[model samples]
Target: MNNIATPEQVTATALLLVGYAAVILFFVVRGALRIKSMADYAVGSVRFSPIAVGLSLAASMTSAATFIINPGFIALYGLSGMLSFGVVMPLASMISLVVFTKGFRKHGQTVKALTLAQWIGSRFQSTGLTRYFGWLSLLLITFIVLICVGLTQVLSNALNAPPLPVLVGIVVFIFGYMMFGGANSMVYTNTIQALLKLVVAVVLLTSGYEHFSQGVHGFLAKLAAIDPALTHATNPQSYLFRDYFEIIFCQIVIGVAIVCQPHLITKSLLLDNERDVNRYLLTAVLVLTVFFSVVFAGLYARLAFPGLQLNGQELKMDKIMSAYVVREFPVYVGLLVIMGLISAGISTLESLIQSLSSTITSDIIKPLLSPTVFSGTGGFRREIWLNRLVITVLGAVAIWLSYDQLLNAKLSVAIFAQNGVYAYFAAAFVPISFGIFLRDAPRLAVTVASVTALLVHFGVYYGRLTPYMQLPVRNPGVSAALGIVAAVVVGGVLYLALHRASVPEKTVAVAA
Candidate 1:
């Protein structure tokens, strides 16, 4: 387990991954032909089965963060991490997905919206608001950086290569193809990735079965023997799982709103009919249930490395899972898992590139510069080319940020991503919620809510406003939850007041 990867191991992993990348490129090429317009690239022109879309959703939702980075948290702090990530968060997110999907899709489909910003803009009847959201969507590049770093970690570890080259290569390859493929190839690649992930998830989860040979209590005893805090329901020593509030309450609230993200929520729009909704939700929820459970593999990882050290060096919070795979699995099994991990990272990365690039091109650049610049014979074609150019720029940004995060991450890149991602979804939660449930939502209220979320989230985190934030390992979830609460409260009050005023005016006008 302590030995470094052999030459044979490195070569085999590289070959398998190259083959995987080739297959993905093939799909991208096929899908590129079908993508003539930006709309097709945004949501795919073909009518796909609900099952395939569902699997794509599952894949996109459970990314490198779920399969790679999260297990490291569980390995560090045992039961508390499991409860928060494996149970509470997933439960809330799935329920939120089911509750929000039908409403969002109905509205999104009706409006012909391709991006979350476009959907928000249409819902509020404000082009300016949509433009603002388009700018805000740039925050998601942080998440793309996260996946890049996670993938780099897995590939670097497996291939025994330096991380920088791997990081550059990954960004170039994935984002390169993504410029043309978009949603059509994205869904196809994601379905295959999801199936691979399903097998790997099973393997990681079951790999730890031997740890429970003497049953649940015995398993707990082993953790307790190493570090008593590991078996605790709430790990007071850990920043994220300090108390019930941080572990359960904050995570659940964040989870409920997490589906509001562009990549996650807009997924339902890929389906062509209302009848397919139920099957899509069913497939997604069922597959994700198993995927989330893979966090429990961290507990097994902890059991394997009692001191959390390898080769006489302290294991990093992010590298524990990679080390575990190398130390635990045999060569062939390790290769399979490595491919799955690569798939896991790439699946979500593709979605992010598609969603973010479309948002930037359609919502931001098109609105700002299209009338002035795109006034030529091949304007429509130019717009499509513009989207590709945007993807290339995004790739460069991802490489830069990912390199910085690789060198200067606090605990893991997960935290960096969560801070940016949580702020985004927190702001999005209020508008999307009101847009779906409340009729005639005042634009002012939605604007106020969105601004409030961004301010509160960044303020709490950077200001170190909370007791939790004061800890060495801060939880972004707490700040984001507070931001969402503030947005709901402020936006709700404003909406109600505006609605009341308008109601009386309409009544008087009718009487006249």
Candidate 2:
């Protein structure tokens, strides 16, 4: 079952591994000496260089789930899957910049300000509500971290080996450096991993295209011979328009919901200046453009190896590149592909853990321990031990969840870390957007934003409503869109009514 390695493949993989290890070690040493205080642990100081912040932002957004699950989905669906759902990055990132950057970074304040709840708490001037939002975020982030790590096992199966040890081994080694290096470690490691993934994908995909394109007529004939069903998306109706709209609607909801993501937003409030916002945005776009190359290559693989299959499934359409790469490429190329996939997976997983740490410390642990948790924000310069302990607990729980999902519920394999966060964001986007920017938005509007979003996201998702289920285009996105519209209409009317009721009619004439 193994691809018998030549000295070259082994040496290349070994060198790549050694290089990755060195990167991890470098971040680890740097973190141990300089990082302290909960603020430093969570967001790094507000003084992070423009490049570091941009790279860190890119790394945070490109999680292990993107590296692993997206390729698998591509195999199952097509390029349209990412184009339909994953294409929300520009919309999401821009909305994040516009909606949150002003509030978080307007004054260069640095606090744990990681999740949307934190922002809501900060903006509206409420502690109790903030804590509540924080705890909820903690639960979601913890789930995300566990799922991301468990995915390494899927990578193992792709490599044609036992997966548990591989999953656990990598998690431990990565988490060690991750904890010590904090945000810095996670960002730096991801930069290296992002570069590796881009390279491996480019080289491998180019080889595949060149090799397959040699006799297009012949290959086309062979492909048509393999799966005419794939000649075009026959099942597009089953999931296309429905899935497309479902994701889009939810994307709109989640697009603004990014305000809730503490890890992504934590750095926003700490920026040195307003001009840096443009620089950060550019970095995000550049990194994502490179990452999208991987997505395109994966989609193209489906086109190139139309007939390439193992046990009736096309190898190119894998959740992990290791399985497909080994089947599609030579032994030497497969090794590089494996290393690249692992690099992407590990880098994203580290960031997920970091989010988990910040969530628990700020959301669950600190709120319960010290009521006035956000008193000062030169970044999390207070409560070092509290932060680490909470992070450790979060890691332990994630390990347990990963173990359970691996042994008991295999379906957990499909749980994507970012997609779930996207759900959270999508649910909150519209309401939050209005509440923050619209002066006419009353307290009732805030209430509507929060309540309507909750109902649409959880209610439709859980089958509490019949109409949504009966509809042809029922999905998270559609449901979220309906929810956002309803909230806006209701909230707007409520705000208008409340304002009119409070004001004196004669006062207007007196002023005139």
Error of 2 at 433 (Å): 1.9
Whole-model lDDT per candidate:
0.91, 0.56
Encode model 2's per-residue lDDT on 282-378: one tens digit a residue.
Answer: 7766776566456545455565455545456634333334445645667666766776667666665666677666666666677676545545664
Relative to the true structure, candidate 1 reaches a TM of 0.98
Give the local distance difference test score of model 1.
0.91
In angstroms, the error of model 1 at 28 is: 0.6
- Candidate 1: list runs displaced more than 4 Å: 1-3, 375-377
Q: Where's the lowest-lDDT run of ten residues in candidate 2?
A: 410-419
Error of 1 at 348 (Å): 0.7
Residues 1-512 of candidate 1 have per-residue lDDT tens digits of: 23457888888988887898889989999898998778999999988899999999999999999989999999999999999999999999999999999999999999999999999999999999899899999999889988999998888888778889999999989999998888999999999999999999998989888888999999999999999999889998887998999888888899999999999999999999999999999999999999989889999989988898888888888888888887789899999988888888999999999999999999888877738566667776898899989998999999999999988999999999999999999989989999999888999999999999999999999999978888766789999999999999999999999999999999999999
The TM-score measured for candidate 2 stands at: 0.80
